[model samples]
Target: MTTVAEAASWARDLEALAIRISPRFCRLEARERARRYLAGLLAPLERKNGWQLAEAAGDASPDSVQDFLARMRWDADAVRDDLRAYVVEHLGDPDAVLVLDEIGFLKKGERSVGVQRQYSGTAGRIENCQIGVFLSYAGRHGYALIDRTLYLPQPWAGDEERRRTAWVPETVAFATKPKLGLTMLERALDAGVPCGWVAGDSVYGTDSAIRRTLERRRVGYVLTVTSGQRLWPGTVSDWVEEVPADGWHRLSAGDGAKGPRLYDWARLPFRGAPEGWSKALLIRRRLGDGELTFYLTCAPEGTALADLVWVAGARWTIESAFEMAKGEVGLDQYEVRSWTGWHRHITLAVLAFAFLTVLRKAAIKGRGPSRLGGRLDPADRARDSTPASPPPASADSRHLRRYRLVILAKTSSAESKAIALEAPYQNR
Candidate 1:
């Protein structure tokens, strides 16, 4: 149950964070607004857009909040750096994993920065949305997103007129999702975010640049790959066929809301790695259907398969972070259109989310690490329904399809009801 002392402690933590980051905001007014904006995000509003947020802050209009996001002369990146440091200080673990993923913010028009009809992992189909590549820190203590970048589609990058209209900086250019993830990863490492393993989906794992960077740093990774990926001059699927029956071990990937997520697992070592380092193919098989998923692992010699499995399972932590930020802290409920507007709102939302993560960590200090206090149940998001298919996008297809259907169903019902109401009037 919630207690008065616990609630007061959380408020104190928020104040501490505000004071720590206040230096980023030059003016006293900006700092106060920043505090209010963060608190407003944490407030239980149906929609945490600028107008609602301003009202919650007791402002006469949204002008102040909107200005704070768009016109404020503060470096969101500097604030992001502070956020990374805060997360490390509060939840850092030597065995922590740095997770990379992207979340799609659904938008309707062309005005929003980085909005285009692209394949959104969130909606499970091509939609008009802005994709933000995010890096999240997942430790035994807790998890939270530490850095993010708005993915500018290639066409948007080349369109000078649209760029000017959206206030996209001239220095900004089109970068693939994996490249953005890599940039965030490098930033975290450079900033001394304590992490031993990197985990991500195929969008990142398929990129050799990311793999090479991790290998060069001698940092280990358990990144997912396509079944058709070549590991030893042969496709991974074909290579897995040669494994003997005894080669497979049934193991629990990690704990979930329900309990342990168990799957049949196997690994095949690759030939070359520097001394004391190793590379291998890690595969997971579903129990009932025997459907398979693959991952490419780079780690130190003698690293146990269970450790690799643990890293693979930990990939979901970022997904959990995305859900909590959006659902609890209004990560996506922004009315911003310009480049600066998007980053400012997103950074504040992340700050609020991190504060909550720290509070949860303190609340469950001796109770053993609860999965974000059992709020990170992937089952709540229908993750288990994801099909074990081979192509690069299949992993997210199920959830995306479900999201699309839900939106379409809602739209259809409203449209049909309106049409019925209009038909009677036209007949009269």
Candidate 2:
């Protein structure tokens, strides 16, 4: 748990960094508003107007906030470029994992850009929502958002009625999630962001073009492919002697205790297939449930087996990132109806999550928790291990506690007395 002074210092540091990135960013209303929004996420307090975020340390009014955000143009390309620069400066690693994922925001209505009745990962059902394809950078420290694009369904982009109704931008075009993902990766690479390999789930893996594009760029990748995905085994010279099999057999190497042994794989070179080809590794693994499945990958021949396994596992981090953002920080809880607001909210939420992640990493690096925990007796430690008890009825707990006091004062005579007694002793 960081102290107020420490958190304030961290906010100021981030603000300074934001200013250094682009002085104009300091003037941008979106940036200022986003900063305040992030602060609010760090320590929210209920107010008459709902939740008033932490006041900007340096006097920022709604007008200044709006002007500041407005000064920073909201173009996707520009934002992506800025984010790429940030990643290069802060988290650049040649072997970093570039994770491609799409998160859905369930919208209550159809007015948002690209909002339509569709399969929303957030809602887990068909709903009106906006999907954002994001590229995240991850390494030893943690992950940060690198780029994002809103996916416009064909009906929203192609239908004149829906387009006009949703206020879709004139330049908005329909792109499948994978296409958007590839575009994001291309932009990141073009911006010189350091990345060694790309990873994604089956949605991106099943697309041969995406894999081929990565191979064309000589980029390594580990992507999930359906067990049914067909591939030819071996090189052109080998295939010339025998007709390629429709499917190759997969074998496992390890036992259940050793983590589901997997092997019995085959490799195929792109040159041999009648259709354009990409080198692929086909693997078979036997499940404890007695099910057998195969997987395909376009990983390079020299790629270490450990590296491939790690890349495949990187997809789960994005899932955790999504869960953390939504569950912990309210990623999908925006009440705004416009596309601009939606993007703004989501961006701030990402930054907030990043801020907390940095704090957690720093704490762990300093060994703060373990060191502090060690100071306690075993009984005390066990007691602390249980879920935290609700804060005592003390006025100085936190702003939320104070707010609850104010609310309770209006409810009942006994509660009002408690509130009255608690107020004066509370520290401002």
**C-alpha TM-scores of all predictions:** 0.85, 0.67
Residue pairs clashing, model 2:
27-68, 28-68, 28-69, 29-68, 29-69, 30-69, 251-263, 254-261
TM-score of 2: 0.67
Off by over 4 Å in 1: 366-428
Per-residue accuracy of model 1 over 129-246 as CA lDDT, tens digit each: 9999999888666888999889999989999999998899989988889989998889888877777889999999999999989888878899998998877678889886766666
lDDT of each: 0.78, 0.54
Q: Candidate 2 residues 55-101, lDDT tens each?
A: 43244344444333233464534544654665555445565678888
